[model samples]
Target: MTDKIVESEAPLTLVGGGWADRALLADLRRHAPGIVAADGGAGLVLASGEMPLAVIGDMDSLDDAARARIDPARLHRIAEQESTDFDKALRSVAAPLILGAGFMGARRDHELANFNALVRHPHRRCVLVGMDELVTLAPPDLTIDLHPGTRVSLFPMRALHGWSEGLHWPIDGLDFAPDARVGTSNVATGPVRLRFAAPGMLLILPRDALDPLVRTLLATPGAWPAP
Candidate 1:
């Protein structure tokens, strides 16, 4: 989507390091066509009974035996010690949507770094599928749908115009800033929908109930602003 070095996977599945997010893992397992392992994520893939299509990253976490177990052609063992393996994997593919698992269970610093990747790669249709919820960064005025009971959360990356509808308490006119603004955590009052008048916001939700959520979000249309 960004004209970068992304290989088309149409429906790609990215593997991260959060082992206990089974609900999210289950959802990704059901939906992803192929898997991309970030560093040591191959264990999750193997444990899940799915061989990875490609393993991209710095090769720090993988043992020689583990590396031997994976198909060599599928391994894109990037040795760039300067960046996180996650970032290396992100640059390697283009999928209409990339569903990732296991990215937030490590150190807080790693977790925050992964979070940064989500927003920075907004040019591609990607979603960081995780335990307890999902995350995606989008330009202002994006709409999202959630399963009737699915919980949703929104965090602003910056201060900008906020106009919302469908939340228990919708904001028609407001300015939200990352340092001092309150985000909206609400339920779907007849299918969640909202629009903003600026750029950049983080979206989160409770796991796979997003089938309907995605359906509702795309029921509108969109433009790509970043990657």
Candidate 2:
């Protein structure tokens, strides 16, 4: 957005308009280091005394106060009303992995929209970081190291079948659908392995899995299967 293309090849942390506490902001900055705001999220970034690389959105919610604090060079206004601010930011940026915060704790509709945006941009890997949980699209093959008895939830945005290993309850042959069936509250017996039949399967794990999951996503090669 800022004529400034992100030259860094590292993953980026995208801050959204939800409930980003100072602690969460600090943690994201520590790991991803590069921050970008989606419209109203600029206020949160400005409050942290740090400027985002660019603010990409419709520019409807961006107030003058927040705008004044940011350098004009960093403001990017898409002006289209077709998509949510999260979608605008995701499409505008090019990064191998994206860690999003302040996107899950707000209104239910907003949270749902954010998830839809993630699935729409399957080529761009992302993990939605919340206070108590982490949500990410299940890659074709995912191996995660978790202690025994850890909670793992699988929510489907579309109908799909999958197979799993080292789980208290296997996901083999299960038809997962958003409106019909879903996998949730499954426990891990040991390290977990999953193979998805299709994209749109979201893996919800404990918040502690954030860093490890991001690492795994970045290490994986190729884009997700085309929708």
Which candidate number would show the highest lDDT if scored against the true structure?
A: 2
RMSD of each: 2.9, 2.1
User: Relative to the unseen true structure, what is the C-alpha lDDT of residue 155 in candidate 2, on a scale of 0 to 100?
Assistant: 94
**Each candidate's lDDT (Cα)?**
0.68, 0.85
What TM-scores do the predictions have?
Answer: 0.84, 0.94
Q: Write the per-residue lDDT of candidate 1 for residues 45-108, one digit (tens) a residue.
A: 7777778777888777877777888878777777767667777788678766677777765577
Best candidate, TM-score: 2
Tell me how far the alpha carbon of residue 118 in candidate 1 is from the true structure, in angstroms, after superposition.
0.9
**After superposition, which runs of candidate 2 have C-alpha atoms over 4 Å from their true positions?**
1-7, 225-227
Decoy 2 TM-score against native = 0.94
What is candidate 2's CA lDDT for residue 101?
85
> What is candidate 1's CA lDDT for residue 154?
77
> In model 2, how many backbone clashes occur?
0
- Candidate 2 structure quality by residue, lDDT tens digits, 122-209: 7778888889899888888888888899999999998899999999999998898999989999999988999987789889999888
Worst 10 residues of 2 by lDDT: 1-10
